[model samples]
Target: MPTPSTPLGEFDLIGKYFTRPVQRVALGVGDDCALLQPAPGMQLAVSSDMLVEGRHFLSTVAPERLGHKALAVNLSDLAACGARPLAFTLALSMPRVDERFLEGFSRGLFALAEAHGCELAGGDTTQGPLNICITVFGEVPPGQALLRSGARAGDDVYVSGTVGDARLALEAFRGTVALAGDHFEQARVAMEQPQPRVALGLALRGIASSAIDVSDGLLGDLRHILQRSNVGATLEVDRLPRTAVLAAQPLALQRECTLAGGDDYELVFTAAPAQAEAVQAAARQAATPVTRIGRIEAGSVLVLVDAQGQTVADHFGSFDHFKS
Candidate 1:
């Protein structure tokens, strides 16, 4: 537990670990709050997400990684909308705060914030069941934020990065697998550390007709864009990038994990068929692979079809927001 005079005093806590990096800014960390100066005509985008132990992550997971992922996932939302991360406010509530935990948490958080170009603004701190909520601010050109409703019939669907590693990692982390081996390492890292597709998301702004981050199952999350865009999708099973670690598993398990498992912060987007080359080039530049996973159709259902066009059942069904 932390006290006023504890080594983890909020002042030192903020200064030693949460320092903001230099970037395109109206202000840096330290003040009533961090201020921002958006370039002329750019609009502001704000988003937030909370991570709770034993819910969003395991209670035994390291605090530093939890801090990083909580922030990174929220930033992923901003990136999905083609926004440049500007600043963030963190709200931390823990049952009992330890100095080591605080220090490690802040260090992990700042490292990602620095890479993502977001400032650590002001927010409240308190005692609770260890929930980390991060609200991030971003900037995008006026009237140009990517919306989920922009997908059109005939647009090619795409996704950045592989799927399922995070979910596999979570299961392994919870001791579900004793034989996971190096596969466990891959999945654990994917789960504990999420790389928000900031650059790809930004580049896709004007190009992708619609986009979303796959925090939920890929099919479930893609349905959001398709539903909003008033179209259907035919997901191609062959194109999903399954890591070697993930592929070594049984086929059914692999498909189930990739389609329904959450926490892989990859971009699922739709673009004109003419833009496929550009999308491929941009992804190449970022050194991130983009796979052409499907095509938008005129119907309203998001369906999966094999190369032979046979329909597959919902692998794990849509991830439920609530259940007993």
Candidate 2:
């Protein structure tokens, strides 16, 4: 709960900053529990994501962007499951009640929520280390949700949007890589704000056999699908779609970021070869670009090859909370 020093108490803080009336749910905030009524023939899909001050983001990030990202990451999980956003709950903790910060955070948070028709059903606030956790609820038709275990041999692998931009921005912030002003800003936007592919995921429900969001890295997230489906993949290094900023970097850096960079938030999915046309149509319907980067194969190993079919021999690992 927020301290008493500020005019806003815990209940007042929640009412002022987090409460919102919801139509989809029978009961919303100010109640003991939220009552969500899933649409007929639809199953409730829920996902939660946590963002700490230093571990998930730099403290220098804008409060608005942080609010957007805190919820966006959870929404990305809903997207991976081919679900439609319905409502959400936010659990927020901070050292003190900063009215300015809360104003900006709520603005960004509600803006995205409104854009996706996700209502704020309930949440909690407290005085502690800065942490934002959001649990989003969505809906999907029965047995229609995309899973990581459906990929099969001979399926075409695809990824939505360009990759590696977020990593480039992070490297620049760390002073590990230098970038031009325009390039850094462009990459920084990718890092600070990522669009969840909700429409793309919904569109790919029947077309894509398996799908996962590129939160930890392209290869790492893809490996989950591969492992679950008992399949392997052959990636065409040159086929990866990268931003102009990332493309201008050295081959090693480009590969490193594109393969192992976390926080991209793009969708990596697989569909049967016969569904290629349908996949393109789904992309068009969503108005999101999709690229075919590789093909799934028999076995459980992922092979990265250049245009010449030569294996790339560099080790790249994704971001793990415990081991990066």
Candidate 3:
């Protein structure tokens, strides 16, 4: 165990906190390279995400939640592709060793990893500004993995869970919006501990035509599918799913938070109208709620509509690393 009295070396810190017995990987920590064996007839799905202090998260966030969020974001990418979690590698950088921080972080990281059967492969730790990078690996059977380029005209657009609450929390943090104590805490949990819809992705394998995780906001992320599939969409802005707190906000604020509020980590997907029942069944099986918010169209233009079928202009762009 790490102690505050003695300076902890990198190898000692890793062994004390990050290293664990291998479950899914052939080789875990303490190796040149971790070995992963995919199931027969399965294709590997991989994704990497880096979180920086002040940019991705606030300085005051608990180390436990930070650890959970770090892994959850990468898992969201796998969920977008209808892939099953297998293993992951973590690269951590911090100014100095904090025993308490490492203990809480590893606890939170391993809890989520064990829940999804994802093993920690191997990684590096170094002294620097606080940053965390994780590369996750998953698997899907051939011809079964979903992609952003599979959407076609006439497909129904759907989103899992809710959106905008994370953005709502962010605005609260920035003092742009004032929320009630309970509401703020609810939104804070949404922001810091997003639930990745992995089971929903697995259930929608054959049912969804295309899918993308809502990390960079719904409209912005959905636009990727649109551009890749060479199609357009008519999104019913009023139909965007959100929590009660977001719903009670002003209409413009609600739209901004739900439409351009990044970090929701929900799955946005498309399917044919004929598969509506199947989509519902899949949602039920996964124990996740999904809302049909739009439909793909032939023209390469995204149109936003209100409840009364009136067209609304989209002014709320999504989060951009360079622009935001």
Candidate 4:
């Protein structure tokens, strides 16, 4: 129940924009707390992501896209753990309650939630600087959640879809790189509304020994897996998959962005060579194309090598909030 008060008040804003009925949860919005019941023999997978204006995203981005991204990033975490989305909670802070902004934002948010069969349970709203934080709940079968520390020597490394487009778009926006009009729009879409590889993650559940989402740059995120698994990797720099938009850029820029560019919500996973067929079959089932870019090896350092078998020196850096 919402109480009437001043125009665009807190309760009124929630009632008008955020309130919704939930199906998978025991209770949804308008309650003091959201209640959830886990299915038999399944474990809950939860992840949270926060997007701050100017830091995580630009002011020029559309509200709907921001809404989609706010939830998508958190869902990507669930996907990496081979979990199916169950529900989510959104905590939004805005300077004012603008009806038009709320309309677009809610529309984009719920659209993706529905696609994954995730329900909006409950959350809080406040008046402050623009920020969107989403915590997503998912379920994975017991003993089946993919982990980062499971990679083994001789496992093949793979990445889903293309990378670097989002980086290219960001560079374009920063005036550091230039793109043709059509190319700019394509790259912009990649940055604004990255598609989390949820289906592909599910498909790779039993196949991938170690899995992670490429939210940060491929090399950087892959480093996390190597560190966790107590192994290393040799990536073929020329073999990284890139879209036409990124391909049009110079080879130097391509390598720099593909190796260190962040914000692309693709999945990178490793599987044994013997499971190669199963990996391809899973990709086909998920309708997501994956490219093998490297292999796990018996070391603790990541090495980049060219086709000529020479060690490649890359000074490119990946994103870090405090250091970068």
Candidate 5:
């Protein structure tokens, strides 16, 4: 073979390791620029999110998990919009470089990207507190992107995966929830290494009339759908997804984690009665569990309910950036 070095530099690192795969991009990994050509009759969706140390996450959170979460959260947004993740860019900041940290972080980030067939195109690096920002791009058919505003009265709301695990995991890490051996390890993983529900989101594309991922607490995020769709909702408290560990807590605490605690990143969407079957089938094929938690009504309000269908008092909880 020829000499290994052929003027390859930082750009080469990006192109070789971070570049998007050949599946979706119209262009390759090199050149002065990147060109994208959306598939015929398809619309492109783009989303961006930022996480700062000591703000979005605890400073003590592990670097590998932090890197994974930073990218997963952004991908979650694209999924909610019914988009297939095509590529992404990362912006990382650090006060000082740590080789171990960088290695683990890159491993975590690239692992998810490969699973989803998304590439890390390019991004900027700078000096500062540890902060990771990811911007992702995706594509969906024209006029087919699910949105918060599409829900109508009588549409049923659904959620995928267990809620409150990440929150409970956080609690365990903070020394609040005591666990024995692997239980603690498992919960910590849930809190740190969250998996974005990309497959489920893609599967729900035509099935979900309105969609949003549970980024903010379920209640708060459901409020987003209600406000945008101009509809009211009655969410049954018992119907929400909860892990056994999370449920083992006091009822009030469980409700808090399920309602206001964030980082679930599970897809929450609304479907018409006729679409429920298709929704069920899609989730089954995707191997993700989905639960019907509530229904849409004609107003812009969210009401909580008990198993008896009695209206429960509004908790008004969920992560609010301004408040947090």
Candidate 6:
């Protein structure tokens, strides 16, 4: 393998690291445009995400992990809609064509793609600041795809897996918090290599009334559902699930992280009160744990409450591209 200083041409770079035989797409790399064929009775779900250096990830992250995350974040979008993976196109910009970095990045990206049975289609590469943009394609049956606007007044709000760990990791990286070595590693993994709950999303089809992936934060992402569904919610702050590490933090910190910590790729969804049993069944079938956190209400404001049913003040703000 050549070093970072090696003069690798554009076509050579794509051919050597990004090219792969197509399995799901009608056409793949080496073409002007990739062709896709969605299955009958299904609607195509498309989403794209961009990650910039020093903004989306730290400068010290391993290339392989960065690669995995670049795709994982986009797949999280598809999971929110209960769509099955199909294919993706990668558009990358880098300061230079470093063979070592390309090797590790492609390895991480393709590994996750193969696990989801998603193939690489066609895309472009250019010389610039390090940036990764991926456009993913998925399919879901008509009328079965989950949306943010489906929650009702009586729907139960649930979140799959845990939240706040990624924010904790980010705090550690930023020197705002201190953590033991192993604890930092665990949280760091949660931040860098989030597992998209595709299986859980698939199982929740026809079960979840509304759905959104926890990319920005639980409270922030949940607001999208509330606004779109025209409903309010009373979240039991103490009931928000967390790992033991995060649980050991201060009460205020724990609430802030769980409520407003972004980068946790878990799913936050709503379902009917009558479908509680069905929701549990779906979780069991998907091998993911889900916890009921709150209930949707008639108003248009989100209220936070303690375990004792006291209304708590809302103060934390989630990640905003411009504000943060």
Per-candidate TM-scores read 0.92, 0.97, 0.98, 0.97, 0.90, 0.98
| Candidate numbers sorted by lDDT from highest down | 3, 6, 2, 4, 1, 5
> How well does candidate 2 score on lDDT at residue 78?
92
Output the number of the TM-score-best candidate. 3
* Candidates 3 and 5 compared by lDDT, better number: 3
Residue pairs with colliding backbones in model 1 are none
Segments of candidate 6 deviating more than 4 angstroms: 1-5
* Residue-level error in angstroms, candidate 4, position 120: 0.5
lDDT (10s digit) by residue, model 3, range 1-324: 556688799999998899898886888899899998889889999999999998889987898999999999999999999999999999999999988899888988988898898999999999999999999999999999999999999999999999999999999999999999999999999999998899999999999999999999999999999999999999999999999999999999999999999999999999999999999999999999999999999989999999999999988787899998
Candidate 4, which segments miss by more than 4 Å at Cα?
Answer: 1-6
Backbone clashes in model 5, listed as residue pairs: none
lDDT of 5 at 208: 93
Runs in model 3 deviating more than 4 A are 1-4
- Candidate 5 lDDT over residue span 1-324, tens digit each: 223545334554454435555555666555555567767888879999999776677877776787788889999998899899888878777775555676677888888888888877667666688888898999998888989999999999999988887777777767877877677776677777878888888888788989999888888898888889989988998889887777778887788888877888998899999998999999998899999999998977788998898987875567877876
Clash number for each model: 0, 0, 0, 0, 0, 0
* Ten-residue region with minimum lDDT total, candidate 6: 1-10
lDDT of each: 0.82, 0.91, 0.94, 0.90, 0.81, 0.93
Candidate 5 lDDT score at position 116: 87
- Expressed as tens digits, the lDDT of each residue in 278-324 for candidate 4 is 99999999999999999999989789998887889968777887786
**Stretch of 10 with least lDDT, candidate 1:** 315-324
Task: Tell me the TM-score of model 5.
Answer: 0.90
Clashes of 2: 0
Q: Per-residue lDDT for 119 in model 6?
A: 92
Residue 78, candidate 1: C-alpha displacement in angstroms: 1.6
Which whole-number lDDT from 0 to 100 does residue 252 have in model 4? Answer: 92
